[model samples]
Target chain A: MQTGFLKSSPKIILRFTDYNSPFLGPSPTVPTATTASPSSSLQQPQTWICFSCSYSNFASTPKCELCGVKRPDALTSSSSTSLSQTQISPTPILGEHSPTASLGEVTSSPTLQPVVTSEGISCPRCTFSNHPSMVWCELCGMELGTFKIDGMELSDDGNVEKTERAQHVKLAFRNGGSASFNNKLKSAMTDREWEKITEPISVNPQTDFDPVRGGISGIMKNVAQNQEEQKETLDQAFKDLDALMAKASDMVKLAQSIKMKLNKDSSESEVSADDDSTFSTYLLELGMSNPVTKKDSGSIYHQELARQLAEFLSALLHKHKGMMVLTDVYCLFNRARGVALISPDDLYKACSLFERLDLPMRLHQLASGLLVVQAADHNDDVIAKRVLEYIRQKGSLTAIELAAIENASIALVSEQLQMTVSKGLICIDETVEGVRFYENIIINYQWDQQALQ
Target chain B: MSAFDFPSIYNFPPFFTQQPNEATWQTQAQLWISIILSYCRFYKIHRLDLSDALTTELFYNKSINRRLKLETLQSIIKMMIKQGLAEWDPPNKKTSAFIYWKKPEEWATSISNWVSENGLNNSIVTLYEIAHGEASEGTEFHEIDQAVLLKALDVLVKKGEAQTLQATNAEEMGVKFFGTG
Candidate 1:
């Protein structure tokens, strides 16, 4: 029953039965109780079949079985009847109820398998791919000492070496140094808890630990000192500001007092004093009279001051002819006092008196005109004739020009002109430019004209 | 000699002071009013500048050292305008004033009457000959400022007393007195 010198094994016997049961081929022999089939041995080598459903399979499979499909007779035959006849010359056959051929996809090429890495895996922490024998994450200084591969540490010596103090210090420095280490130590042991606990036992020739607690205490002392200094500086600044404000307020009050004094006195008298005081004190740093301390000693001084002021004012109006700036008069008033006697209010009163007495004052008129104080009411005909002759000679005379000629004020010239006019000897012509007195009686004197006729 | 009578004691200095007092000033103004006008007419002063030298002698009289300022002169002139004794000439500040001791119309009437009385009415007269020439001899029209004579002539022309014609010289104009009465 052997074919081509290949012996049929027991395992090949099932494949032979599976190939014959389906639509792959008509059996040259059928499985029967009556006879042991010799051709069945030869047919096992030729037929490839489905292991699951007894269908014909391909020859390339290592073992004959239903791979993925479960149906009987689901394997494909290449459709070569001649090769089938050669392999199974005396073929065993299955009955007419055998299953159909398979419709599954097939290809000749095989799929590749996955390869395992040779070196150690990259660390999830620092991503440094180190040797599997190493017990720590090298780049990030992570302790991988506890790793158990098949219930044993990867390197016993490597784990032991890491526990040494020098190695720990090296790693600590690399991981943000002694400062970070101290912080971590402090966080782990709070101040209260550390106080309750025993101090660390001092070891000789220690590099990492500063055996005394001085470093931390020194840092805390420096921070406290800095905070104290800042507080002192801020307090000093506030003190300076308060002093400046006090000075400003004092100045304001003084100004108000002076103003009140001016209101009570005359505004005119204050004007001159104000100018002189400012000039004298321009570069001075002190004694700017504070308003709070000015003493107003009632109205007695005011009366005395007013009388003197009136006299002074009356004199000035008689003396000066040009427009007098109020400030000049104030300076004179302030100076004449043996002491700082007149208040701003009194100063103001003096000016008002001057202004009020400008008109209706007989003294003012005499000062202004041809009538000398020596002869206020008298018309000095000598002066009148002189003026008349001068005008007669000059044809026109201004107030000043005439005053100069007659050796008198405009007041006197004005007086003489008025007297002359009243006597019907002259007439005045006034215009926006100036006044001119004409000889009316002299022109219309009629004696010569009457004689001519 | 009556003008020599002194009215009161002359010791008051303010009497020499220019009266800022309006009533006193007004009285003062009125007094100077007549004096200035009369003096102007007496001197034939149709124009007055009121210079310092003139004011010195006229108002002060040199008996005292005090005098009126240029400002006082201006104030007096302003006062004079109120009384209608003076009119300001718009073109000249110093020269503007005209004293109307007699109005322009009256001067014109006086001239016409004089011409008629002299039997010279209806005569064609050269303006220069009438004002400055022999025809004006011993008359008020003699040697008048040209402006004043023209103003008088214009008044006469308006009154139908005269007519004017341009003359050969620029300033020599002619006047013809037309009225017989």
Candidate 2:
């Protein structure tokens, strides 16, 4: 676990090189960083207190120059809180430890002011400052600011106390100096599971060290294993598409079979014809992949548009009782065009051109000022008969109600009603509520009776 | 507006408004003319007030919640006058109309027949008796307008079937019908 933490440290001892570099120093910045580690990544001057001389000592001094005794504390004066309480000389001391006695001998102060590094970070455990750019502590090879190492290692081994070396290495790894291959792969899958898992692995040869180089051989083997599975699926899809393409001629054969069966019209064969009708309907929907547009037919735009509209509207007219509002046709036509939308004027021009076209559609203007495209087969008499039938069921009908019955606008219904009234098929009633239509009752009127005898 | 006396077409709301189309309006006008005649005949109402037709029960059709427009009412009345079934009583404002549900000739025949049935031929009878008298009470002419009654009498007098006699008062003018010979 500690070795994992050392993965991100900036520097490594010559002997610990194998344990540290996972990317084989492929990045040029990684090798130079270790050589320049002492001055740039670490190197903060500190002062320590001597136990025998009762004097402040430079942290670099191994022994007190005044009493020839070793400095007892491993940490600096500020770091060891109990160092002053342990013992004092009990007398005024002099020698290299006393500033007054050696003012000239020392020549210059060895203590450096604590630097306010605007860009670099100070190591939290050792308190030795480190460059913020460096991900690990250069002095102890500790992972700098490694939160995951603390969480993952502490969670794993709560009872086992970490050794100094293990703790230092653990700090480096958790700070994200160089993540393990398994950890990187695990995190990569967190986003898009399918794509990230299949994506080729990228390596930064500098900080990642030997693992990038060492892990390549292992990764290739895993990829080869996955390649076999993907190859089978592609081959299966290709086989299915090829099979469907081969059977295209078979669809026409089935249609021909139904045409033959339709002639027989037996009660048993009617079921087969119904099935064929559904299949034919599906085939019809597939027929209109290529639509005529201005780019396709140029100056013949209105003429071709009119022809195409006739085919589309004939079906729509059958659905809407042989007539539909012009505005509704505009919406349906533009929606079918997808991206290339035509204006209302364009649709109107196309519909008007239907006069010359073979299509049996006519633009009719109702007396109430509503425009509609109606099939030629549905004339005024047919509509009047329908209106009469509707009245027969409902007894009497208003313009709005009749509009709903005929799937037309109220204005169109009103105009149709006016025509029906003129034809003597119906009569208009103007009441306090609104206008309504009823059956014509007056049949004859010329007969006058002679006075009673 | 009594249901008993009202025609079925009176319940039809469209009958109140005059149609705009020539063919439709012609048929509708004829229908209105017939309804007005039958309605007047049933109620024995000889005079029709044009302004009152809009607000009064005759034209204020409650079932349809509509009223005949004054112009449409006048036009229909004019049609009746052209057909000789009605006449403008005062001829100036044309405000009031005298509806002849029966033409003068028709009334003359009806009254002449009444005189023969009652053995009153060649006998003197006051004009008031022929109109408001008890004998005429069972007929449509009972309480008929004086002008219409004089017109009916003039039709008989011109045919020489009745002769007018001098009366002491205008209301008591008398008529004598000749016996069949």
Candidate 3:
């Protein structure tokens, strides 16, 4: 019986101890069993023994009533020795007697009789007995499997308070089983406290929390810190870019100094003239010191851009033989400007302003609608005379041959040749050998006498 | 005649290709007109077939390997026709044209002069005898194309200086000339 109580006590303790209540009922057998030693119990002062069943009886009874056998002194002596042995182990004694003591108290006391039920679980919240198979109270709807200590007070006061909130139920066993149950329950509570103390220590370091860092506030703080770090990295990248730009400007200045020195020494050196001119042109193309930008020039952007463009292209136009296609100029101008690149529309508008601004380099549109930048000195009349001179010198000249001689593109040369043809200074022969230009002889031919012959 | 002397411009490559500019092309057209008239007169070529002319040395320059395109030659011929220097031979078809180095009026004056000089005024003369007879040999009108001779006679008839006697056969046609009254 003691072994059975020990086995069953733990299950009841585990279930009931979920509620942390200070009012866990005390063990009724603990005080008495501890104080009354086994030697004192061996005296067997007031109780009479039943030999057949080894049952303890009241002092008034002499027979072994459980089996109807007569009580003998030898059997009484042997039973007393066994009782003393059982009393030496206090848990077994408590387990053996506590159930019978609770049962006697249940029968003798009228107060507890209404609270105790014969079958099924009783809800402490309403004292409603639910069916054994039901997990919740049928009347109060309190959970039946677990006891809630909060409901125990209402039951103890015997005052039923009805509220809209769901009520928790406390369990109270009436068969003295609660004494051993409370003992096991107290031991489980201590074990839970031990776990609670060691839980933080066992957590992984990444999640381990100090008093200042634990919940949503901590995560928000970390996000803010990460944003600060990102801003700093972005600022560092911009600083590096600024430093690179400064170094680039310094290099440009050095190249300009070298070009100045080469120009000063150019008259004495013959071999370096070509190299020096090209190098100076390269330096000139590196980047303009102050390129006209929309931000800087604002409303007069195109006008200022036109002036700057004329200044920039004047030298280049001479190098390219006084003409360049508009697209090629756009590329070269943007390359020299470096950072402030202009769109095609902007370049066109700026070139259009060349006539209004009276710049040396004007935008020239060919018969085919192809736009070109030509030096102001390189007009149709001058180009016609140049072509006429070449044709007169060579007797006849194709566009390709002139392009090779002039070191200009065939398209530009051909356009010049056509302009000359339009001016009546030169004529073209389009044959299987391609278009060839010749001096205008028909204009000077004496028609009257020539026709008469 | 001594081999016809070609103008220096004839050897020019651009002369073989038509010009594109308006003023330049007009000048080029005049040059071509003079060249064509002189060339036909030198060769005594009364009619020019455009396709056959394209391959001839008159239109193609073998030394320079440049040939005047057909469309350009046609345009030149059209220009000449506008000036009465040339006429489409079959009239409606443009494939061939008659080049008048000496126009019918000029040929009529030359024939009237020849008749008066021969003292044959008011005398009927067969058109074939004027064109192919030994007496008319070495004359400018001698061996002239029959069609051109008839055109020259028609000019004289319009001037009231000559009258044509038409026969059933075209070869036997005759004309009587009168001294210009």
Q: lDDT winner among the candidates? A: 3
Query: lDDT tens string, model 1, B61-154?
Result: 3453445456666667777777666667653575346666556776787778878887887777776776778877877667666776788899
Per-residue lDDT, model 3, residue B154, is 94
Q: Please write out the lDDT profile of model 3 over residues B14-89, one tens digit for every residue.
A: 7777787788788788888888888888878888999999999888878878888889899999999999998998
DockQ of each: 0.02, 0.18, 0.40
Evaluated at residue B20, the lDDT of candidate 2 is 59
**lDDT tens per residue, model 2, A292-380:** 67888899999988988888778778877888889988877665554356788878989988878857998887776678999988899
Clashes of 1: 125
Over 4 Å off in model 2, which ranges?
Answer: A1-295, A367-369, A442-453, B1-4, B19-28, B54-57, B60-66, B113-126, B134-140, B160-169, B172-181
The deviation in Å at residue B48 for candidate 2 is 1.3
The whole-model C-alpha lDDT of candidate 2 against the native structure comes to 0.63
Q: For model 3, how does the per-residue alpha-carbon lDDT over A1-453 read when each residue is reduced to its tens digit?
A: 323423445443432332124212222222333343333332223444443465654433447557766665543443333333332222323333433453343232433222324585576567788544443456876544321111111111101111111234466897779888778867865555534533332232112111223234446667888999999999998997778656765666787788788888897677769988888889888757777889998999999999999999998899887889899899999988765679999999999999889888889999978899999888877777877888889988889999888787888888889888888888777766577788888667664545445
True contacts kept of 2: 0.28
lDDT of each: 0.46, 0.63, 0.69
lDDT of 1 by residue, A1-453 (tens): 123211343233333333324423322222210022222222222333343444454333334455555322222222222222223322222111112211111111122111113565455556677544343455675433212111010112222222221211113266556887768755643432422221221111111111221234435656888899999999898897767656765664565566556555545466577654554333121222322112543544444444455554444434432222344445555544323445666655544444344421222233223212221222346445656788788766667777776554565467667766555555555545566665443323222222212
* Candidate 1 error regions (>4 Å): A1-453, B1-17, B52-56, B90-96
| Candidate 3, CAPRI quality class derived from DockQ | acceptable
